[model samples]
Target: MAKETYQSLQAQIRKLQEKAETVRLKQRQPIVASILRSMQEYSITLDELKAAQAKGVSGRKRSVGTAKPAAKAPARQVAPKYRHPETGETWTGRGKPPRWLVAAEGAGATRDQFLIAQ
Candidate 1:
């Protein structure tokens, strides 16, 4: 049998990666659905999820002679700064503006118009 060419080996690797991803997704779909259902049933907030994760990490005993740094504290959530009058949608005035705000701006509405009253 002839030795595999560089291109042929690369093709085989790509095929294997795709196959592995397919298997992974198949295995994870049920797990993801179960997690989502549980989260919705419990009305679990992201903050609670992060708190649980942090609790899990801190509860684990550190190995002898290990010197890993402590985990950073979870970020505080900011209150919304803007709200749509009609839809009652809100934004925290952080990252990129939401689509509704941008489209309203294009339609001649000023950003300040959506500012939530203090």
Candidate 2:
């Protein structure tokens, strides 16, 4: 029954973190190798995949860097679900708040105050 000192606990935590990171990298190695193999087999480039991913996420038609569009379009377009009252700013309530919404919150307005009237 030994009591753990702060230094001992900290060292254990660092050791566990390093072990976890090593395990994570080991888990990721097969995926990375598969991606590399696929790129080589299909004659696809990483830049092309990145461009396609960006285009699909933003729902924008990017011309300069993208390859030919896939047979399907993005899943669907998301309509904005929230709007600022005074500034008439809109947000889809998906990822992060827009600057105007953040400012409004800073000014003591609650998030529900910006709900788009349905």
Candidate 3:
């Protein structure tokens, strides 16, 4: 009859979530097995399944393992295009120029003078 504390309520929620997951898996196991059985009986291929999904035949599309969304390729590092002669600061020619480069330009130094030699 006593009111539950915040910690007790949180613990209950965690326990319920675990129980729900177990129940969900248990419930899905039969359905997944039946689907597999049907696929085997009908000789259905993964490609066919993907095609159906692409056509929006039914339900949301799913990708398993190798067919899942591809991880994007890593971005290549850009080489610095300009470097300060005295301080040795570098810039990749992207975005705004650094304070030193701006100051140097303001002081009558040209960008061509700061270009790093190939």
Candidate 4:
């Protein structure tokens, strides 16, 4: 009888633990959502957070107060392959067409007309 009761109590504890975890997750959702919203509002990036953590580990004081802005990545510049003769507007012909190119195309202009002289 004691062994049966112990087994029953163990089963109850398992059921209670499952219920507690579900409740904990339900409670945590709002907190987690608020944290995400706050991070978005402040424009906090993951790299900034990691940098701050690294600074903390290294005993840096300045970075602890404010995260240092990451160095600006070099802008990728592709030489323009197409140019408008009149306006001199240039494009690399890579991504979406610029407004001028779109307008010219809409007006029955072929892309070959805009090709820069090599």
Q: Top model by TM-score, which number? A: 3
Put down candidate 1 lDDT per residue, 15-115, tens digits, no spaces.
99999999999999999999899889999877898887767754665455877868999999999999999999999999999999999999999999999
Per-residue lDDT for 1-118 in model 4, tens only? 3556888889999999999999999999999999789889999877887887777753654445577858999999899999998989999999999999999999999999999888
Weakest ten-residue segment in model 2 by summed lDDT: 57-66
Worst 10 residues of 4 by lDDT: 57-66
Off by over 4 Å in 1: 1-64
**Candidate 1, run of 10 with poorest lDDT:** 55-64
Task: Give the alpha carbon lDDT tens digit for every residue of 8-117 in model 3.
Answer: 99999999999999999999999999989999999998899888988978676566766866679999899999999998999999999999999999999999999999
**C-alpha RMSD for every candidate:** 21.2, 18.5, 12.9, 17.5
Give per-residue lDDT, candidate 4, residue 43: 99
Candidate 2 lDDT for residue 73 = 62
**Highest lDDT among the candidates is held by which one?**
3
Winner on lDDT (2 vs 4): 4
lDDT scores in order: 0.91, 0.87, 0.92, 0.88
List of clashing residue pairs for candidate 2: none
Residue pairs that clash (backbone atoms under 3 angstroms), model 3: none
Candidates' TM-scores?
Answer: 0.44, 0.44, 0.48, 0.41
Relative to the true structure, candidate 3 reaches a TM of 0.48
lDDT of 1 at 39: 89
Please write out the lDDT profile of model 2 over residues 1-118, one tens digit for every residue: 8999999999999999999999999999999999899999999987898888876854776666767777876678789999877767788999988999888799998989788778
- lDDT of the structure predicted as candidate 1: 0.91
Positional deviation of residue 117's Cα in model 1 after best superposition, in angstroms: 0.6
